[model samples]
Target: MLGAIVGDIIGSAYEFNNTKRKEFHLFTPKSKFTDDTVMTLAVARWLCGDKEHRKETLVRHMQELGRRYPTAGYGGSFMRWLHNPEPQPYNSYGNGSAMRVSPVAFYAHSLQEALGLAKISAEVTHNHPEGIKGAQAIASSIYLARHGATKREIKSYAEEQFHYDLSPQLDDIRPTYSYDMSCQNTVPQALLAFLEGANFEDVIRIAVSLGGDSDTIAAMAGSIAQAFYGIPQNLASYCYALLTPYLRTILNKFEESIGVLTPDPFDIERFIKAQNDDNTYQQALKEILQGHKTSHWIWYIFPQLKGLGHSTYSQYYGLADTDEARTFLANPCLNERLREITNALLIYKDRNIERLMGSSIDALKLKSSMTLFDAISPNDIFSKVLDVFYDGKKDRNTLQIISKTFNGHISNN
Candidate 1:
């Protein structure tokens, strides 16, 4: 959990750095926690509550904390769900799972129980499969790490279990947000950040530098790193005053359940134990962890986030980077034109109006359509939105034609 805290602080500083180097203050008077911390507190608070149905516990706690900390960036769909007379989950699969999964990992008596609780807690808000998968992956990794799994063992299991491409390199993820948001992508990457890390601070630097969902990715990676690496003496020593009097008590409650953790330092042996004859393990390892490759947008997006105001994140924070602009997009309603290829193909591939002439799917339902034009107007919103996005200098019809042609490369049916 403190890993999440440290990740929050570390990434808080360099969220847009795109590439990482460890040279900065660990936390600041302005280095406050985000929804990542608040929701984590919610999960931790409820896991220790009455042994009621896990979903009920989660809803109650999430609702309570969300109201208590209404200002922290929350996904919009979730916020709407929160105020509705009867809350029902919107099938969202954002990075919320990765951020709030640690409490179960440390608290569960066994692996199965930890996984079960992680699943239940995830479903309370994120009904989407990818969301559930992402949460489970993070919690399981935390469980393995706490129970004495080595970095190699954790990486191997994550790769084998989820088929993640676990490359530890962070040079490419910056400036864009296009990686898969599923456990297959998000969890393993976060773990690899810790697995390849040298210490608590290293974990955050690696995660934020890797980009994609920078803050959440770093926060998730940090949560796991805390357990594997243990809190830094310097950090815990100095973190005392960062919290409000309220959080100080919360930390004590957080520690109360620490007694139940049962780490089995030998789990790593299980991986190597197969080394005796399982020739297949090597091939499997290669297949899953082949390349932890990432793209370049991870670098650019950080600057965009930090540069949103008169102060760049680095300038405002008096640190290298600390932008919180993307927090507004937490609502899950505002679509960033960015997406993982898998998700893009699933939700937006042919939904565009450009494809109406070339494809069969409904074009009116495209999110871009909603953003571009209101149906109340007879004018084609698609053409108008294109004109605006590109400036009125370009022909609206020509832009629509261009969008269709480019979209064809990605759409087959």
Candidate 2:
């Protein structure tokens, strides 16, 4: 649920001023929660508040929250329903249904419960078939992800059950996609972004890069990504900080109700001071970006990587600890270009940490990303990196510069 809210806030700035590029800042001065966060919290409150799961309860919460955050960029029809004395299902097919449905996934113990609850949540206003389907599809994907289903299995289930064509890659979808609010147009693209992403942050970046209803698309994708690949601690802290106290209180209750302990946000001042105190944090980033894959820096930094649930990135990747992460990073067969791109990804991850810190990610997320980076074929990694950092357009000069810089470093060594 926080993952969805994080995406909403990050993409909020870019929703109106759409940027097809993924290199933009994750947050800005203008960034804030929108209708997506408000309605999502409403659904969450309904799930946690009402033991009977009544539709009337859902409607009341939605109306109350919506009225409180009236300028949250809600669609006109939904706004009318929020204020109406006799609100009814408007039979709308908007992506709003999918954006707010993530909480149902976290609250459900089984896939069927997820689908059923998703239906109840959507029908309050979006009684249209696509709206219900959209909600169910996202809810089911997140449920499957949390239950340890592989991406392939989740993709097959969504394709077979929801009949969404998850086959189209983001590279193919980004060039021609436009501003679309309908569930049919929004849900599939969001799901596809999740399917193609390398990590949780990667998924958000991919969804935002698609450039249509950016926040909702990223929100839907981020929810599933969080289920599949748990969010980094730094990112989670940023998410919590951007939210209101009431929203955070509801979020805390919702998580507690589901048997999940809400993580406390890191003290930014202390975190920044820790970074300044540890020279290896900066040194590791510098050496890795310079194309030297030393295991000692990784070992040094792993101890400082404090996270919420999982301890280290290696563990997240199913390995034991920093030793396993080091072994994974020391892949012998990666060609020159693949190694350079891997270094570039490490640099990219470092930048994300800097941005979020205002500053080490749980370096576990970074290590796990590298572990996955090593597992994928070189071609796919190259394509994904270009799509993300280079905006899906392969700029040979950039690759050439990375290669040359790496070669220069090797010669100096």
Candidate 3:
């Protein structure tokens, strides 16, 4: 599903200025996600949240997101449909149907379901048989590809089911192909691009090189390519950073709902277990655990949620890099939590542990803001009281005031 967005962004720069060769840059300063991505997310959100798959619900999400990103290169008909008080299908056969229909492939459980959902998604605006067929053909091809179907099987299925001529090779189609908006003209060429490519990026390059409706063609091909080869981690991360927070949230939620999770780069659970098994660490943990469970300590150390057996934080929070570590260190809850852990372990004076504590304390103090302190009070006022002990700079009166504040916060919690 995200491959569609990646392709859209990569091809956006070359859409109007067609490039008939595959060696061009994948992204330039002008590259950005287009209508293909916005509508793809809308369909994915619909599949994630709307169990009944009602057209009214689908229409609401599409219109709502479409209006939110009004200048995403929407066609005249779709733009009108977005503004309409009561829009109806325009019986159009634009490649928009296929461009936005990739989500259906990921959301559906079977090829039959993929075809059915693709039809429902398309008929909201593209009620034309060709439009709906174009969507179904793309969705079904993706479904087949992801479910271990060979390229031959996918080509045969698309040809037999949608009657698209999959016989033309890219070399035959590329030179003469020009700008085309019709699904029939675009869908088969896009599939041919996918059929010829060796990997996900290669498919997108092939589609873009066809010299017509570059973004949409690449989106359709990338959808299938992703299902077949999976997206490269670096490319996926790059594309993910381009989305707005709202769009990123929806994309993450939809992927989570579909069990398409980020791969864990490290064995965090094993690390935790190893730490737990160390007698020195375990003894220190027991003293400072303060009636709190190890789970609480775990949460403080690794703030990201668990997924598919590992921490998703490393992926979503950008925490795997040293540069990004500073961002997490600035997190108030994490800061306070780490402070509590380090403070508790302070008495042990284990050289390695104390060194880590010293560095963490330094970083926290450097990044600390009054807002972080203020935020920590409600969630963990106890940490505030301990700070006086750690600093040894608070006067007796300040200690008294902090103790009172801590007692009050404990009661509130």
Query: Per model, how many backbone clashes are there?
Result: 19, 2, 0
Query: Where is model 2 more than 4 Å wrong at Cα?
Result: 266-269, 272-413
Worst 10 residues of 1 by lDDT: 317-326
TM-score of each: 0.59, 0.67, 0.67
Where is model 3 more than 4 Å wrong at Cα? 263-413
Q: How much lDDT does each candidate structure score? A: 0.55, 0.72, 0.72
Q: TM-score of the candidate numbered 2?
A: 0.67
- What is the C-alpha lDDT profile of model 3 across 1-413, one tens digit per residue? 99899888888889999999999987654677888999999999999999999999999999998887787889887899999999999999999999999998998998889999999999999999999999999999999998999999999998898898988778987889999999999999989999999999999999999998999999999999999999876567656655655677688899999998774222223334433555534543564544322322332343321111133322333222221233445545445545656556444433332233345432233122212333334334334433433442223332332343332121110
Tell me the RMSD of model 1 versus the true structure. Answer: 22.3
Q: Which RMSD values do the candidates have, in order?
A: 22.3, 17.3, 11.0
lDDT tens readout by residue for model 1, 174-261: 4453445445566666877787789877887777766555567777888788778887554543342233334444555766666633
